[model samples]
Target: MLNRLYFIFLLVPFLFLSCYDSNGDTEKSATLPIYQDTPYLQDYSVKYYFNSSVSPKKVFEDRNGVVQVLGKNGLYRTSAGQFLVDGTLIADNTYRPLKDKSLNGISLFQDQFVYVDDKAVLSNAWAGNLFLPHDLENANLLEPGSNFDFLISDGKELQFLSKDKAPWKGTVEDGNIIQIRYGHEANVFWILGKNSVSTFDASNNQIKTIKINNEATSFDVVGAKLYIGTQNGYFTVDSELNGKPSDLINKLPVPSITWIESIDEEIWFGSDEGAYRMDIDGDFNYYYGKRWLPGNKVVHISSGHEGRVHILTDNGLAQIHFDPMTLADKAAFYEKQVRDRHIRLGFNASLVDLKNGDVNSGRLDDSDNDGLWTSMYLASQVYRYKVTGNEEALKNCYESMEAMERLFTINDVPGFPSRSFERSGYIESLHDSDRWQHTDDPEWDWKSTTSSDEAIGHIFVYSVMAELLENDLRERAITLIDTLMGHIVKNDYYLVDFDGKPTTWGKWNPEYVNARPIMVGDRKINSSNIIAMLQTAYHFTQKEVYKEKAFDLMNNHGYFENLMRPMSEIGKAPEDADDWSKMLSEGWNHSDDEMYFLGYWGLYRYALNDTLKTKFKESIIDHWESERPEKDGAWNLLTAVCETQNFDLDEAAWYLREHPMDMRSWDVKNSHRKDLTFIEPNFRDQTTEEVLPPDERQVQRHNANMFRLDRTGGDGSEEYSAGDIWLLPYWLGRYLGVISEPRLNKE
Candidate 1:
């Protein structure tokens, strides 16, 4: 129902729904600058709503140049950016006040406005009072063509009527007729009947039917070609491409066609699925439920003054306006856009649907690492709620927390988070090569033997929630953290699976972490993670055993030295080293950077005391200084949370802003751009001359190289969401007091 949009209440805090009016008179101006510097971007849209009971039947601009809308019950008038129903202002602009009116369609002729009521009464609106212009019968449709020349069809006959004379006629079958139009220059009139197209000379003499095949739903004449719209889709052909003027192989991207309108260099197709805009370049901008329309059921379209196009849908009336905006505003707008686009609500549950590009409008499926991504998204909201006291943000935090905590109960293993979870019978396995376990409950299945990444995520989210959420939720956070941390400590610092052995990457025993040389990134990262988890446990539970274990890893086993290694100090492993360690050290460990920074929040924030922070300060600054060159926004904000060094807030904002609005994981090519300066490729395979904007780089996670040259469409691309990537830093900035609120001055 249209009312659902009003109560979808937990939408992004920044997107305020303006009162929608069928009269096309919402006060939102599309001219607000998006970016303060770059004002050339013409990317802005506004949504309008009508009274729940008022659905638009037709819409047009009046002769006086004001927008007017015809609703199921009455006529709506637009004046001075407000819609008035029967001359009375309604409290909310979303619903236009309905009043009794006799007219439902309008036209202009010889300076006199013609209005047609449902009863087939034709009145001259400009004659000071309602008066019939001519005796009419079954005039259901108005063919408003030239000022003096037009035809009205009541099924069997087409009346060639004039403002001052009796109507003349031409015969046609009732239901078989589609539409008719007259060409001024050619001095001929054409009839687009369902089965065939027939033409006549200006004198009304039949001039034979054009050779044709399948029925044409609608058609437009431009020069020598006919643009045909059909149930099968759109086709274009020369007036007589062959002996039989068959439809060409061409088709629009939509499923079925209803109406076609051509505007300047663009062609618009209104279909059963939605509206499509194809530019001269053949690129398409599809409008569907989430982006522009409240629903995809488009009824009719009317091109209005300027670049605006009015779309009348079964739900309400809306207009699409194009205007210039700045890049900054564009960046801010996308946050709201991505939230609505990627968030999926189902069965009282919500999750960040990461692979939106893959699913499009379909339902979202769980990724192999749903918990990991949800942890990051959850952390961002935790920060937002703490900073802004926004109830919506807190609600989102609880929803994701509920999902994250499910990972523990999903399997028999006490605290092992599955690689992913899904309804039973959907798939046989999580990975083709890895074993997937079926839980005791027959309704669900979850992947087993989860790696340390899940463990780290559990600790991070739980630690943050424990501090930020109130009473009951805070107590719940403590339970999750203690259970996961207790599981690790109980299994000799490893994530034990259902089969009673440590998961491959979950091994954090001193033997494994200290087994590799300092040059291997894993040695440093694993050591850092275990210590952080131990410390976070101590902070939440105030357990003496957690602090003792952290000290044991730090002092006896040299985990402190391992954690303190500067990021730049690592290099290729020694030639004589083990095979696995050498292979790991062959290149910069970008994933280690992700794991290290993600762990940093708990490592430093919940440190046992001030002295440890003072001792760890240099290591933190050095690591950030080395990472500053890459300009990773997520890492920078995590580093800023340590509060021991200066952060590049502008650069962080740039990374978030420069992140592309088009989150589709399409293959992007920036290596060939003339604007790029060539530079030597790095070990991580980044080939850009310099950091091209975030939009041009390979679709990435916080773990991937930010400046990597090419983005592989869906292949070699990680399943990621703009929400987690954006939310991570945006909330971090908020927590750091850098970004207070979005600068969208006018909602």
Candidate 2:
């Protein structure tokens, strides 16, 4: 009875197995792998350095010599070789020769020197302790005294640094001393702190105080006008110090003001983070961290001779020489530095095989390697750099692209007849008869179904290569495109698995039953890849097919819907389309929802569709008129959208003016566990485990935000991406024609 039961169980499985064709024969076979004969890798190197502890904090030059504040150490003289400590000269080779006491502040008047210590003890002398004066009222000083300057210590009860000494010497006032600054001329000065301003006339022996509620941080005198930098904001008072000062101007936001000085005619202010210069007309320019200063936390700023500005910071001293000829030259220099530091990597082009018959299941470059796709993206950036008149960048891009091209097969096939290229070092099969089946879990499975997207990347790359190369290579590109089209048409616009079955495209939840022609055989039609191909094809052939494809994809599919979803879902119009059901249902699972399909949104408005041009006008007004309550995700999204769409310049300008992406806590990091719940191990090497640190994850999000700020289109936003050759042309073509007010808010 047991043997009979076991036989029945085996017979039942055999009966089910015989239900389908036992031969496992299909109409089509898997395509043969097209291996590129010569595959090459590009070699490039970059070097970077960070400042040392002994780096100078502030640098200033006088007719007598160059002076620098050595942070905790006292002021050092650069004119003579040896270090001057007190009155004596130290050894020539001594790197740090000053005393260990914190020298918070320093100022030079002719040959005399005045400085405040960590204890807020104001001291002055002609030659280091000789003829020292210290009779002034010694009170407890504040902790952050680094930004303080020595106005005056009269060797008596009250010091007259900002206000006139004659009248205040005898009078008693209860107002708090928040900040002080000496006027351009003698005996005329201004003093301000919490909610009041005190002015005194020394020769006339007259004193006047104006009560104000705003918190004043620092003040500076430019001609007769008194510019006050306060915690609330910046305001300018008219020349007359007496009576209620009229013609007050307030426009600029108040960053933590540390010190203010006049450099030539420019009003330069030292802040807690960095330094900024404002024109007489109140246009402000900022230089921070690696830009003009050595460190972000600027302690003090002072003017030296001959167009040079000296800056003192918590870290070290820095000197910036400005030429009035081109005001933005300094910013341009730093931009170049940042661009040189980062390099991208990705593949540009691929070949499809169709001889063995299974079109959708055909191999990319006859294999599943991904390096080719990776190199192309990196090369794309390089290509942009080259075209944008960055000679060095162009060279790097060209070399990288050339190296990528060498890693392919240079032979003719049935579907792709011209020379075909595959990703470097990827092998298709080990067994002859079972080429699709792996005998040994092949090294870098280039023939895997996961490589289908990479194949599309190759097609896009060829479009770029077509423009870059000349003569025969260019002709080969056309053939490559034709072959790719044939393969796609035969495969029914879908990638195939190694078992000759159609594979699903996209990750997680994917849309699109049939892969759109615009996106080739990719799972879903995405704005990024579509725009890339459209731009490349348009630039290369100036073909109507490419333009039509871009237009059709833009309108038919929900590209616009996806792009405008964030701003619209917040209840801002016709553009919104009320499409939140899908998003809302997904909820936290949609962590990547806000990841920004920047390529799509940026390119759609950049493409500038005439059909929806009128709709854009209404959308712009609606977006501006609507109130934005939140300061986080929605505001950031709208800001980016407005910037890219060039919709409401006034609104975008208002946000930028009101909430400049604060760089104060720029280096701070937040946790990602609140968003992404999972951390996967690194796959390339099984030995190493990869976990996203809270800071690193936060930085990635912040970087995306910064990229928005830097790349967003509009005169008010930073023009960092304006010079980006690859992306800028598309931006200019779309928005430049739509003339609008450059300034956000009308004064």
TM-score, one value per model: 0.57, 0.49
Give the Cα lDDT of each candidate. Answer: 0.61, 0.37
Clashing pairs in 1: 20-49, 20-94, 34-326, 34-329, 35-326, 35-327, 35-328, 35-329, 698-711
User: Cα RMSD (Å) per model?
Assistant: 13.5, 20.7
lDDT of 2 by residue, 200-299 (tens): 5554546576665556666777776677776444666665655454433443323566677777788887776566677778666555433234456666
Worst 10 residues of 1 by lDDT: 18-27
Candidate 1 global Cα RMSD: 13.5
- Shift of residue 732 alpha carbon in model 1, Å: 2.0
CA lDDT, candidate 1, residue 495: 88
Score candidate 1 by TM-score against the native. Answer: 0.57
Compose the digit string of candidate 1's lDDT tens values, residues 292-393: 443466766666555667666666555665544333344344445445544532111122333423323334445655666777778877776676565666
In angstroms, how far off is 700's CA in candidate 2?
8.9
